[model samples]
Target: MTDTALSLNTIQVGANARVGDYLALLKPRVMSLVVFTGFAGLFVAPGTLHPLLAAVAVLCIAIGAGAAGAINMWYDRDIDAIMERTRRRPIPSGLIEPAEALAFGVTLSLFYVMLMGLAVNWTAAGLLALANGFYVFVYTIWLKRRTPQNIVIGGAAGAFPPMIGWAAVSGTVELESIALFLIIFMWTPPHFWALALYRAGDYAAAGVPMLPVVAGPEVTRRQIVFYSAILAPLAMTPVVLGFAGWLYAVIAGLLGLAFIALAVQVWRETGERAARRLFGFSILYLFVLFSALIAEQALAPRFAGLPGTGLGLWG
Candidate 1:
């Protein structure tokens, strides 16, 4: 028997994988962000979706994202076992078998995509399929170990959720949806690189070529600042394009400045604390940006006369 088989056998003995262990394989926290952004896309799209259909769309997105996370855990078990932050994950910690995780992920992927096509629309289903495939085949298997640019390029997978959500409602991809996609795409590098700065040691130990480990922290910090600069203006695209109102513009402007300021702090400081701060705030920054969009959309009727109310633009 192969050593890997023997190891699996040994780990399987007396193993007690539970429901929560299975959930852990899905990476719920990451799934939450995906669902939120996907919902934002759906909510802000120009057309209306039946509330029931809308719920299905969001559910499909959440499950599809979780499936991708599960597959990632299965494929990266080796590196995950090596990384301190990931060593205790279900598969690596022997709470769940690798093959089981893979099968679970594959099943969920098929379920969500097929359901989306049947219940929602084909365009949304196709995008969900593409996103699942990209996260699994492209990001997890292709770029992760081979390139420092993995997250930069693979971020497209995450960026697809909003577009899919928009398509779910509009039944087509549009310029406005693309704007949402760009906002997330451009925000990814700086957000991830900040975490990479503090987690360089973990990534290096696992042999994953994250930017901070590959090009050094100094370069990573600078890149963070560069992306933040571009993202600051990019966040205001909805207002510039006439879909968003002045309220969104003002909120986005203030948030963008804060994002850039934090990025600059990361660039100037030599300590990991600065990187950690950026990492924490990056999550908040995105949550707030999208929240502002959602709020504006919800409140548009009541505040129609206010400047930049985002009221009349939707078809």
Candidate 2:
């Protein structure tokens, strides 16, 4: 959306830019989580895809996520340079030129979408495109600096992978997929807000309007608790909705309780420690919930009807 094409300024980096630099541009750590969630969606969907196609679909999701990350770094380079936490990023650190990152993102985005359409299904490709567009155009360009609700709306971009995964296998977006979507959607606010709570100065310095920076930590803490409460119930809906099994229900309940407990600490305590604890746990919370889904959908079915062998909403 910002004219990245004309922002190329070459810097002296003969040996500084390596494979790792490019990979960092893609945000590999974040990409891994996106790929896992998308794979979980494909796994839990009612139907199946050939293993090769399944792998391709997951690969596309990863590339698309990386592409979006690269574009984000390119667009936010200026603010990134200002923020202490992000000041060393490739674009901001001058490891990779903004134009190069932009080109890499655009090329990867197009390549993955076209590859997905040809190798998997058009539905999944379309979803991938939508996620990329929303992250780049809507979140980065339009909402991030302008609103405190950026994470609330931008979070939707991260929520689409599982739906894309489900579409890859079922060729449709089903209620079960919607459940996965909601889980992430509700989880995003508290997760990012926790980080924002501790990094308020960085956001403020970068001129980004994070909730913590704009509304004050007290308000941010209350908002985090509010979202965490809603998220607990929303997370368990999949179990009641009959897509996930009872094992997921038990785990979801426990994790939700734990999440709320942490949120309460965040609300009661007034410091970075509580917020950091919640932030770390929130990542683990999401990974475990989705991983449980993968286990329930993929592994437990083989041991169905056996005592203590299966856990899920459906056998």
> Which candidate's lDDT is highest?
1
Clashes of each: 2, 4
lDDT of candidate 2 over 1-315, digit per residue (tens): 345534433334423687888999899989888999998888777665777788899999999999999999999999999999889888888778799899999999999999999999999999999999999999999999999999999999999999998898888877878889999999999999999999999999999999999999999999999999999999987677666778888998999999999999999999789999999999999999998877776667543221121112323
At residue 94, candidate 1 shows an lDDT of 84
Q: Model 1, range 1-315, lDDT digits (tens) per residue?
A: 999999989877326887899899889999899999999888877766778888999999999999999999999999999999999999888888889899999999999999999999999999999999999999999999999999999999999998999899888988888999999999999999999998999999999999999899999999999999999999998887766788898999999999999999999999999989988998998898899888887778335232322123432
* Clashing residue pairs for model 1: 245-308, 246-308
Q: lDDT (CA) for every model shown?
A: 0.89, 0.88
Can you give the lDDT of residue 149 in candidate 1? 94
TM-score of each: 0.92, 0.91
